[model samples]
Target: MWRPSVAGPRGYRVVENADAFDIARIRPDETAVVVGAFGPFLKALRGIGARHFVLEKDPATLRPDEMGHFRPAESYPRIVPQADVLLITGTTLVNDSLPGLIACARPEARVVLVGPTVPMLPDAFLDRRGMILGTVRVADAEALHEVLAQGGSGYHFFGKYAPRIVLAQD
Candidate 1:
């Protein structure tokens, strides 16, 4: 369960995938730095005709065509600080790299922590200057459990059992 971190009007708003992108307000000319090889995010960015840079530790995660946008993780220090918008994968938290990544972003830049691994908690990220969280919500716990038991992944449970949602800080 989640609760507001502030009193009176809500500091965050719930939204769908597209709306979350809109909240970032990324322009075609502006560059967005993505900290992972998240395919869905790449697709959405392409759909909006936005230019972006992707950083990945593994080259295999990107396709031949996507290699043009790929940057090695070590280049983050030079690349991340220039981003107008930054989208970081939640896996960075588990790897203990999230703090360094966040520190690289400009204070005025829009930062979003994205992926199913992202927690619902807003206060924690808000304190780090994260402007939004893109995560999944399990609507049917039983169905999700069944899918996991069958070795099914996001492709099987998404939309039906678990749907994408965004928590945007105000």
Candidate 2:
């Protein structure tokens, strides 16, 4: 089970069942973007048979394991209006990029922000046209670290946190 770190006044809450996330539902024709180069969510995207990804990496050389199945973008200002989903890691460092990316997303795009760093409030992204599809929480830190140290990705830890998918308020 996955749980959100910052829950309501009551207590910690599970957002989604461990088996609920079915990536096969996503159409193979839909384009998606994975911001940043690492994490479990990236692995999840890969398991869902996702292709046509847009990754952001610095000038440093990437290891073969780090690249996974994703291909690099040829240039910046990569306007992907054809994308059906945009998966992002919510961090203060990339706050400014959110609006721009949202603006570029197609009208039907479903935007997901994963990781412990994501803002707790849905209002933060409510005004945007895309749907804020919820997040995944790491319930056990020690296990998470162990998996990472062993070279594991999110797909390996999907049910570790009691993952939840929240539907943004209209």
Candidate 3:
């Protein structure tokens, strides 16, 4: 179960994955920055030729060939200011880094919070141009627990134990 730090009208709604989660929705002219090491995010950005930067705290998680693409978290003050779109992981919320991360975003940047841990509340998030939430709702709690216990990823549990959904502020 999750709780919100600040609450107000819930402005987000879950929808099917058809057009909602399109990473290409990002304009080709826009430069993107992903805050985590998410595989699908790279595939989507690459498909559209969006020259993007990634900031990952753990350099060990990246492949040897991919090391050049990831910047250390310490690079935020430099790299973040250049981004047109920012993709952040919801884990930032739990770790109490969300506020600082959001503060770094430029006024014109579109900030997106993604992952299962993304809060359902939309108050603080809505102040930005409406965050595109790439989240999931568990369809079977027990099955999801089992998958995690066995070291499964969202690629495994999606549609079986959890269904990936997109929520946007309206």
Clashes of each: 0, 11, 0
For every candidate in turn, the CA RMSD to the true structure comes to: 4.0, 6.0, 5.3
lDDT of 1 by residue, 35-129 (tens): 98988778878877778889999989998877898999989999998888898898998998888888889998889887778888666776645
Scored by Cα lDDT, where does model 1 land? 0.79
What's the TM-score of each model vs. the native?
0.84, 0.58, 0.84
Give the whole-model CA lDDT for all candidates, comma-separated.
Answer: 0.79, 0.54, 0.73
Candidate 2 lDDT by residue in tens digits, 17-49: 432223223556666666655445555656666
TM-score of 1: 0.84
Lowest lDDT sum, 10 consecutive residues, model 1, at 1-10
Q: After superposing candidate 2, which stretches have Cα over 4 Å from the reference?
A: 1-25, 59-76, 92-95, 136-170
